[model samples]
Target: MTVQDKLKQVAESLGVPFVFEDWTLANVEIDRTPLPAVVYVLPASGELDFKNGNIRDNQNGMLAFLDKVELNGNGQDNDSVVDRMKSLAMRFIVKLNETGYFELLGGVMKYQVAYNKLNAVTSGIVFDVTLKEVTGICERNL
Candidate 1:
């Protein structure tokens, strides 16, 4: 399967309310989407490497987990909300690592939590991923 297909599978396994691809299109509807969602964007173009007449594809992508932030009456973010998002992000990372389907090209497996504007105050984690594919596979052809 393709990287996008693998990512979609991972997203579905998380059981989020929504799973979207192509952030450009999904961003327009994020405000309307229900909370606790996952979105990923993978560029169509990738770097190609040739070795001994074999080609390798390196693709870069991003995945995010979004959720509405709970706010206190004082108009401040609730600590629990932030903690929940972090916990969820950790779970996602664990799942990603467990898949064993993606071969990371480079970079460490780290995510950042950021504030986002949605229907309400939102917080989420953005994860950077790189997938490597070597040509002349055996499984599918076989």
Candidate 2:
């Protein structure tokens, strides 16, 4: 399965909506999406290395937890929302690790919290990922 497919599976296991790279709320329909959603984006370019009869695919991506926020209206507290997102992010990382499909690079994980103009808050983690697969170089060359 592909990286996006694996992420969708993780999102399904966590019982949250999964959005691709485009999670912008500019569209009115997007505003109606349920809160506490998972957004996955591959924001950086990737590299492919062919060595030792194997292909190494490395890329950088981000996983974001998004929720609707209320300023004056009665809603969940901002701190609580952020805390919940953090917890969810941790769980997500655990699940991703269990998959063993991606190798996470060390010292590149960054947790960020930001608010958008649509009164939505997001907590995200950025990391580098690598996927290696053995290629039958001899057979192909023959």
List TM-score per model, in order: 0.67, 0.70
Full-model lDDT for every candidate: 0.64, 0.60
Which lDDT value does model 1 have at 139? Answer: 39
| Candidate 1 lowest-lDDT run of ten | 133-142
Query: In the order shown, what is each candidate's alpha-carbon RMSD?
Result: 4.2, 4.6
> Best-fitting candidate, measured by TM-score?
2
User: How high a TM-score does candidate 1 get?
Assistant: 0.67
Candidate 2 on 1-142: residue-level lDDT in tens?
A: 5567777888889998877653344223336568777776654666666677555555456667766665553334666667787787778878877766566433556666645524343333333344342222233453
Clashing pairs in 1: none
Superpose all Cα atoms of candidate 1 onto the true structure and report the RMSD in Å to 1 decimal: 4.2
**What digit string (tens of lDDT, one per residue) describes model 1 on residues 82-120?**
567667767766786677765633345677765653445
